[model samples]
Target chain A: MAAVALKNQLNAHIASMFAAGFLDKQFQELQILQDDGSSPGFVSEVVGLFIDDAEKITGLIAGLLDQPVVDFDKVDALVHQLKGSSASVGAQRVKLSCEQFHSYYEAKNRDGCVMALALLRNEFYDSRSKFQTMFQLEQQIEACS
Target chain B: MDRRRIRVLLVEDEEIHRVVARAVLRAAGVEVEEVENGAEAVRRVRESGAGGGSGAYNLIFTDKQMPVMDGHEATRQIRAMGVATPIVAVSSDSLPPDVQAFITAGANDFTPKPLTKEKLGHILAKFGLA
Candidate 1:
């Protein structure tokens, strides 16, 4: 099965974090932010919020492709949101690409966004799965230990 | 000069951020290597692994926003591939929760810009590299 083939990838990273003796402060806090209401599943709630934001931005960016010259200024706002949320999670390289994409938007240049998109897609695509796995693994590891 | 200085790999997309990080790290006695994007960062790591040197990258300081590969994905990719190089997230986003998330995402530590001595020192100390 697909799950069986993909051996847990975050084991070493999590182990290293424990070895370093640092708690996952940001994730814990983000959990608090999402759980301000103390809902049933706080962590999922926050990540879901982020996912919704990602969906809207993706749709917005996609819609721009149909325009005459692709008003980059309009797209820049979406890029900023993507950049901010990603950066909030310390997605540095993706944020940097978005920053560049935002600046280049003023010149009405589309190439920068394209390149930034490649990086952003790679960042989100990789992070969503890996982070989710890491979180679940962390929970399992905690339960076991 | 002495063994005190650390070798830092900086992968960033913005010119100003690169300059600022370089200055901050240099002031902290770190020798910085600059790369433009995530693609180059991965290539550099691979090259370093293929007998390029001791295959040691003391610190990898990256910006969250980049073009070819953003900081988070690059960090995730590097970790997923089993690179031991300690990565530190450097960006302008100062939200504490976000900083924590960066660490959770497998960054050795996190620092937001404009790089201050306190933050840089704290991060370096967290990794025991200061």
Candidate 2:
């Protein structure tokens, strides 16, 4: 019964994310790929990597911004990487945030870039929390099964 | 078009992407060899020679923005070595300029990232490998 409850909660949380535009069809594609491998926790594993990558990249971006002379190109490169990584995982909001971040850097708008960074950071944390919760629920289901 | 005999070299820096690509390709009965960056890709290709010979790859899929060496530079170097294997650019950025850059650098084709089986099948068939 507990397992069933956890499963239901997982389903609801996923639906909420999808409905909120935090995820897209690409997430489903990742899930499908999970079945093609021996590792059943493939999606969770990838999600975990995405979070770690985001943290590192965002930290770098923050450090770059704090410098006296912001090297926009370096920050843009990081944003581009984060964009691709987020897209790969179907993190819709984070990818969109990266795009906005890139645009500000391109325009050489320091203040705008700072704002975009905040947006991207917030989206990353939100998605990270959701992913962890979803993975924990999945682990419960696996154990009970 | 014997899938089992088809060999590919996949160059991507990100671990998750590499894992996904390997699983997807293997499931389709295609043999895949992976490398982390374009420099390794160049070394691997040179080591194998060309024309899908015993140890050579039949095709190449390289990510655009990798450390050590980017995909464009790698493609140019491979072409310079006269390795005529079809090199396809695999990236998330499909902008015209991005696509043009890879092509100018010697990639025969371009495929957007977050690779799907359908997309992979289409690319393989286009190259007469499927």
Task: Compute the interface RMSD for each candidate structure.
Answer: 12.7, 1.7
Tens-digit lDDT track of model 1 for A1-145: 3343233445565444435432234444443434443444544544454556666776788678556779776687677666655444434444556676665677676776666666666656555665576668656654554
| A100: Cα error in model 1, Å | 21
Q: Alpha-carbon error at B1 in model 2, in Å?
A: 9.0
Q: For all candidates, state DockQ relative to the true structure.
A: 0.02, 0.59
Q: By DockQ, who's the top model here? A: 2
Total clashing pairs for each candidate: 21, 0
Model 1 chain B: weakest 10-residue lDDT segment is: B47-56
State the lDDT of candidate 2 residue by residue for B43-65, as single tens digits.
99888756233237878999998
Which RMSD does model 2 reach against the true structure? 1.9
User: lDDT score, residue A123, model 2?
Assistant: 95
Q: Rate the local accuracy (lDDT) of all candidates.
A: 0.64, 0.87
**What TM-score would chain B receive for each of the candidates shown?**
0.82, 0.92
